[model samples]
Target chain A: MQFKLDRRVHYSKRMLIATPVIAIALAVLVSSVLLVLLQKPVLLTFHSFFIAPFENFYSITEIFLKFGPLLLIAQALAVGFRAKVWNIGAEGQMIIGAITASAVPVYLVDSTSALLLPAMLILGALGGMGWAAIAAYLKTRFNANEILVTLMLSSIALQILYYLLLGPWKDPMGFNFPQTVMFQDEALFPALFEGVRLNTSIFIPIIFTIGIWLFMEKHFGGFKLVVGGLAPNAATYAGFSSKKAVWSSLLLAGFAAGIAGMSEIAGPIGQLQRSVTSGYGYSAIIVAYLGALNPIGIIFAAFFLAVLQIGGDVALVSADLPISAVHVFQGLLLIFYLATYTFVNYRLRIIRPLTHSNTKPTP
Target chain B: MSTIEFFLAGTLSAATIFLLAALGELVAEKSGVLNLGVEGMMAVSAAVGFVVTFESGSHLLGFAVAGAAGVLVSLVFAVISISFLANQVASGLAVGIFGLGLSALIGRDYESRTIAATEGIAIPFLSELPLLGPILFQQNIVVYLTFALALCIGLTFKYTRLGLAIRSTGENPHAAQALGFPVFLIRYCAVAFGGLLAGFAGAYASTIYTPLWADGMIAGRGWIAVALVVFGTWKTGRIAFGAILFGMVSLGELIAQSMGARIPSQLLSSLPYIVTIVVLAMISTNTARMRLHAPFSLGETFDGVGPR
Candidate 1:
């Protein structure tokens, strides 16, 4: 007997929808086994992952709170990822965005101007773009690998954040912790609910979702980016600039990440601290791939990951699992998703041995 | 010892970690495979190496086990990217994240634990000479091994049939396959070897250099090693030079901090990453030179059929 992979004549739409489901199932199964190995309550841990996030109103809002940044960052990353322009350093861009946005409130401390938030948003985006632009410039001008440069920039950005937090921007009245002064009410986004942390900032990612969906699905510029990713030579032959694709992809990703970063400071965080993004930039990469780089698909993926994030936090107390376990689970989901995605392009075929009589030239 | 001698010795020790990992990555890239999971692999090795050494009280045993763990972790990357034909970058990132999480899990209980640093081996006559003798001849066993490995790699690439085969596979796998080379086997072996060295680098960090188990201890060293390969333009000798240069810069940062320099330690700590971005840009600026040195099939999957 022999096995072979034959290319499918048509794209498998069924598998496209089912792939994430299967991947999630496999990840859950594997996590259950791992939990058992760790002597944790497997079922309860999973309850926290799958059921706990939806158990109450606050937790539900918590999911959306997490969803906002994940959605915003993933949508932008998916676009750049599609263009084959890797920008793994969104974390750094996000940090820069947070810093730039916080600069407004940090300097003014008592501002009641309604324009502060708006200014912070734009400055936040520009900061992220500026950070990302460094990588784009290096990539286009010198052919430096953006993956490495962006990652390096992330490390540097973190240091810069630390420098500012520990040095000049350290809260004057606070206990000398390495963080900025809290933003005034005018600088903060209006809360969506009376008690919950969810804020009007959630609208930003939703608006971005609609905008990116239209641009990717219904625009010629998006077509050019796709072409640039799928076939660089073809894109070049068609008069599309590959350099433009690189610049635009990185800049857009930076822009979205910047806004996400700004929203975090202006919304739930209300201050620039050490753990601002909480590895959202990296986790959003997983979200982007889970959605298969589709703008609409990312909305669901972001929500699902948001649940996992909240659930993981819950499990920290309920299951006595460490925070790293969530990272492990996310990694497994991506690995399984990538593995199963192959079936969409190819199908397995099995061959059986022919009978001896049938092999005798069929009489 | 004089301060300069102490600094030089530290530089050499620091260089070994990057040297070992970058050498492994260099070989893997030569065979047209890019395993970006070096950071995660090193983390796993560091954690495992520390735990093994802590438990058994044998650094050698720790290094061996850590090296094995690195190979096993990298095989995850090999199967996903090579066999499943997934995107190499994404697969590598997945493997990297997994390794990091796994390492954290493995090292959770061992945090803050310490082990005895590996003792330096001194050549009989060479140890007593002068500044040069103490700086160069006296070092840990792993350091000597790394130096030897680098020399062996340089010689192999210049003189061996295996080297030619790997290079040809990187340049054009189809042509190499048509010439009857087993491309898959070569790539798998190359990636595995890269994992082994990465593991060694990690083990050295946990077991010898720092002799401590700490979360994220490997830090960005793995990424720096990856950049070192590019900074060297994929050449073994130049890579060694770049590693030493990085080692010196890192040591210089430590020295500056200790000297009560007014610069913030955070800023000093960030210097290496900044330098890496700059050097990467500088080295990559010459497109012709880069094209000539870089493996044509680097980060690309082999379809296992005729050329696409």
Candidate 2:
């Protein structure tokens, strides 16, 4: 009645690809049981969760709209994750990004110059980088754990956002609301197509996907980062600095997250609001892992996650399901994915007990 | 009550929550596993404890159920990180996210519900003592338990063979494994214990401290507990001190807000987290001290392999 896991000498590629698919299937199966427990109509809930998101052009566009931030943040995170540099504070970084990007619209309310958008994007990226730098500096110089530092920084970032929204940035004419005024037309992102919320910022992820694919697959720097992650001692033996890996990876993630924040404010949100603290930064972590930390995989993974998010919203309205159901689904998805991912590197086996008579005979 | 007394009283309860959670994490980290799902575990247990207490009308039963719920969530984390040999950080994050979501779902119905606050027990002779008695002796049973737990844990680490085993396990799992200790099993237990305490802390928040069930009510106290472990340099006494210090700081902000401080409330709210960052950075800056105090295998996954 004993079970054991034996590590495989070579990882199975098939299992690597199949793990996510199997994990998603398993998550859906388990979630159905949860729906039953929650007393929701399982079939109808499933229909809304899996099928209804694609029912209309608006919802489909909404999926891409959500996909924009997830893709950018995940790709940015995948870079650091590949380097074993955990920057879980992208949420804070994204917040800072949004805040920094808003400065232009908030202060230069009447400006129509085209440079405003570009300047805002740059400032947003810098803001995210600045926030991430705190973590990086601590990790590199003081040997602080980046995970805790980044997370703490995110809380600080949120407070800063709240302070601004509640104090300085509160729209003077919006009847005491704790939000900024809508951005001017110059600050807003131009739509990419008619009849949808999708904007030109979609190209950022598309371009970065190719850029990351090339950087990871072909660049020497990327190879060094991989080496740093895989074998730290060997990396040091080859003269690769771990500190550089930490900085580059975190800064890259910060930059991308900053862009995500910028796009969120400029594209979909159109202003810095309390709602911008939505868990895109956290969800992107799942997206990064779900994509197996690869660019191509991240695209599909981000798309699936976006669908879940958008579909979860639909279920909230149509199936009378709790909004927390989506969070539960995501959490379950990550757990299941991690569990199934083990099959790529290990195989399960059953161990039978030896009979006492046989042992006595041998004696 | 004087402002100082009010502050001390508030600090005692606040410190208790952090202390309970931090003590659990201390044991887990000492055994060489870092469970970052404290936030999620607290959230779930908060919801569970609140709902159960609201329904059963027994705070004791609520605390017990909350601890069980915490253990259940931690078991999921143990399976993922220990059995599956997944990345501990990623696994912990997943557990955290899942716990938050699950708790929120369970708490949806109980959002507006409130429970009677747990009354502080007045020590017959001690309550008549000067300032110290009111601050220390007159507190909820859980608060006293938290202090006792810290003392027991401290004594355990210093005097017990079990403490040595845990220390050795965290210091060098491979060596411990070769010595016939079941590394994975020990880690699983440690993680589960951490969850239990974190759950108790959450229960305290929902059933006693605030005495209300709200989605996400645990609100970063779990994280503060996590930081407190590091801030204390993973020692029991220092951890208690750090918890009390943070508790005071947190309460100070509320007091400041109440006293008509001009500073934005959000800025005041951010004080504890910012302090955590600063203190963490300061402590970590002396790499020599950090390396000495921190378990060498703190976040490393242990395979069931003997030393080669």
Candidate 3:
């Protein structure tokens, strides 16, 4: 028997909603096999990966801390992804943003101005936009592939961060460590609770969620962006500028990633250091895809990923599993998600072998 | 050998890594398949190659196993992007992430470990020559093999039916299918071939060039190899030449340090990537040239039974 993929006349909405759940289940199952291969306790590992992060208040706060950046970056990336403008260099943009925002705190070590934080945020956004704008210009003017360009820029950005930390930005009074001075209180976001790292910075992502939802679901501009991605020819026929879509989507993503970067330095990190990004840019891509590129779905997806990230840390101590296991899980999750997503639009059918009786003569 | 001669010789060894992978990518792209997981594939192979060579004390066996591992991993990408009809970019990224994670997992314990470097095999008379001998003839076995592979691939594209079939399939899958070519099979072979060479390059890097196991050692070389195809405009000879040019830039980092140049090492290390961006922008600006050389069907999904 031969297998065939038959396009569904009308896809079931249930499958569309259920796909992420199925993908998660499949990822867990596959990861269990990997755990068994490594001679680790599958049950305990699963506990840490899914349950341990929620057992206590501190871990819960940690989840939210991670959740903020993932939410912000994923929402921004989803917009561009919907418009089919690939910007995988959010990490680089975030780094640049962090650098630009830190300029305010680094240079103004004694400032008590209330506007300093706002200025930093704006500068961070501009930094990210300026970085992403380079790719936009190259893509529009030279037709260069954004994927390669952005990725290369990410590598370059890392070097720049290292150069600064090692050379100029090194904290002078605090030994020769490769990091800048901690920000003053005025440059920092206020903590939501006593002794907790979770801060008011979380409001940024919450606000962005609602904003993106309204924009994509209600605004005509968002409709045009979606159309441009889904059908470029139709979008062009209707006279929506694809170039503008590319520029806006990339710049917006850069803007969001930049804010996420600034929040990182201003909230929990409180200083410019080497581990600034922690792969948030890459993880946000998975969140974007897992959420089906939807605003509301991204909320849940980002939260889930944040929990898993916290859990992955717990497992490092409790289960003795390598940190790479989290990356492996993420990879499996995305692969399974992409595989199962195919069923949303098409159904598989088995074709019976053609017998002589059923066979038609050549015309 | 003088500094210039030494630089040329070092450049070839450096270029070998990118050349092998780029040549493979050239073939895969020629068949209208864009597998963006080369970095991941090389990472996995590099880890596996280092471990195997260290354990078994045979570089050949390590390379063989690495190539097999690459094929196995790349088949995951092949099945997902091709058979499952997933977005090629997303699928490739997932595969890349998975490979990197897997490689790190495999090499976690093997970090800081060293392996014996593969020694250069000298040609009898050619080794006696002064200038050209050290620069070209006297090198490790993998270097000579890569050069031979590049030549063979270039010649095959010009003279062979299989080459025509692969190129035509890349140019237009529907027309190729109508003309009785097995598009899927050819693409599968092309991707697998690309995987094998990437594996070889990775193994060469770990077992011969660096002779050590380190997490993330493959770095951005795989991506540079991908860019090299565009820089060379998808031609075999030009891609090989581009790889050597990058090799010189990469070697310049070491040379500058040795010379005690005042420039920051980070800037020098970043030169290859910067050059890749600049070269890509320059090459891609010529739309007519890109249109002439690029596979028309590259990155587009081909469905035989879809309602077109």
Off by over 4 Å in 1: A351-363
Which segments of candidate 2 are over 4 A away from where they belong? A356-363
What are the per-model DockQ values?
A: 0.83, 0.83, 0.84
Better of 1 and 3 by DockQ: 3
lDDT of 2: 0.90
Clashing pairs in 2: none
Q: Determine the C-alpha RMSD for candidate 2 after optimal superposition of all C-alphas.
A: 1.8
B23-64 per-residue lDDT for model 1 (tens digits): 999998999988999999999999999999999999889989
Judged by TM-score relative to the true structure, which candidate is superior, 1 or 2? 1
Candidate achieving the largest DockQ: 3
At residue B152, what lDDT does model 3 achieve? 97
Q: What is the lDDT of residue A132 in candidate 1?
A: 99
- What TM-score, over all chains together, does every model reach? 0.98, 0.97, 0.97
Output the chain A TM-score of model 1. 0.97
**Alpha-carbon DockQ of candidate 1:** 0.83
Report lDDT (CA) for all predictions.
0.92, 0.90, 0.92
lDDT of 2 by residue, A241-277 (tens): 8888899889988898888899899988888988785
